[model samples]
Target: MRIYELGDGTPEVSVVGAIHGDEPCGERAIERFVDEEPTVERPVKLIVANEEALDAGRRFIDEDLNRAFPGDPDADTHEGRLAHALSREIRGTTVLSLHSTQSYAEPFALVDEVDAVTRSICPHLPIEYLVETGRFSEGRLIEHAHTVEVECGLQGSEEAAANAYWILRAFLSATGVLPAPVAGDTEPPLSLRRRDADEVVVFRLLDQIPKGPAEEYRVFVDNFQRVAPGDRVAAADGEAFSADTEFYPVLLSANGYDDVFGYAADRVGTLA
Candidate 1:
């Protein structure tokens, strides 16, 4: 784990790089932020956990880093051990983990209900979407750390990089690390919700694509889209079907590698 020093105040924010190897945009974005180091005085720590997995340029060598957070110290994998240590180190750390997705969703903050502090600080950035954990999924980094995960954009996509640039500056400014927002950036009033009933849904990556060729026409869709029953979503070999009922899904991902194991949801009406 590497810490980049820029600001001068007490450490309050610990922004994380890619916990997953395949989603290296956050790692790359952090590097860019370091190169043009902002003058933040606050104790803002930035780290890239699971270096080996990240180096592999794959999601993980054995286990997913995001799911490994707050793990047992005696865990078998390096990622697990790292998560255990990292969790302890950042126990009281105000954290933000940048992430990306396949859909062109706007940059959003997906955090747990416990992260009211992070929710309080949301307005410092220009993200329109603020997702809650149950609203997205379990076993995610933000859920594990009880921190905030900002969806910058599609993983490795240009949007992810571009958003990371300005969002980093906004983070520095909002955290009082930087005296002001970075150039060409104005902090948008963050849409902080304790939880959006309408935003409730679990997300997953579809992994088991059908085993035959020419049946690969279906692609991932954005979160919260309506799925009609029997609607052929995508097919690996068999005819993939959708729910017959009318329920809104918070579709966090539209597509990824052929990992057809995505999430299904049961939303509890959100609080206004």
Candidate 2:
């Protein structure tokens, strides 16, 4: 983990990046923002996690760091040890952890569950959707209180990097680490802007859309779109599976995960 601190005193606001080495957008955004030497209203810690995996240019050296949170210091895996250390650094802080995804090209936010912090911070973010991970939170960093995880865009894309930077600025602004962004002051890329009279749609993870072993896999539905009962959702080796009930595809994509295509989510409500 590499940490950069701005202003004075122990930071209660933090921005984390590069938790998964395969997603470089977060690291790029953090580095670019630090290069500007922007002044902050309060102390903040910016961290680039999983340096060893990042250096190796792989998803992880031993295991996925995001799934290894509150890790054991004496754990055997590299991610396990790193997770323990990273957890300590961000403990008691309101955090923004950056990430990119293969399932969606648009940015979205995720939290362990919607709360006062979610209501307060998510609206200021440049996103149209907020996900409640619920039981799926497991060992993820968002399982920690007051932490928000963002899927900036398609993994490793330049657009994702740009989105990550702006998202970081928005998070800091919402947390009072930086001043609020003004309209016509600076243009945001990819049509990203703060919520203006728009309510963010909230989705709760209901279950994982499991995938079976197949030589070829294909998805027939667009993510975030509602799937009706008996609609063909995906195919594996020429065999198609249809949904038995209604659902909104969250992170649905072909070849995104080994054991699952993505998640099945329900549109819970809107966060204004």
lDDT of 1 by residue, 90-209 (tens): 667777787777654457666665345654566566664454555344556676544767777777777677676667666767666667645676543342222332332332332222
TM of each candidate vs. truth: 0.74, 0.98
What lDDT tens digits, residue by residue, belong to model 2 across residues 79-159?
Answer: 999999999999999999999999998899999999999999998899999999999999899999999999999998999
Which candidate should be chosen as best, given TM-score against the real structure? Answer: 2
Best by lDDT: 2
Residue-pair clashes, model 1? 33
Worst 10 residues of 1 by lDDT: 202-211
Q: Each model's number of backbone clashes?
A: 33, 0
Task: Please report the TM-score between candidate 2 and the true structure.
Answer: 0.98
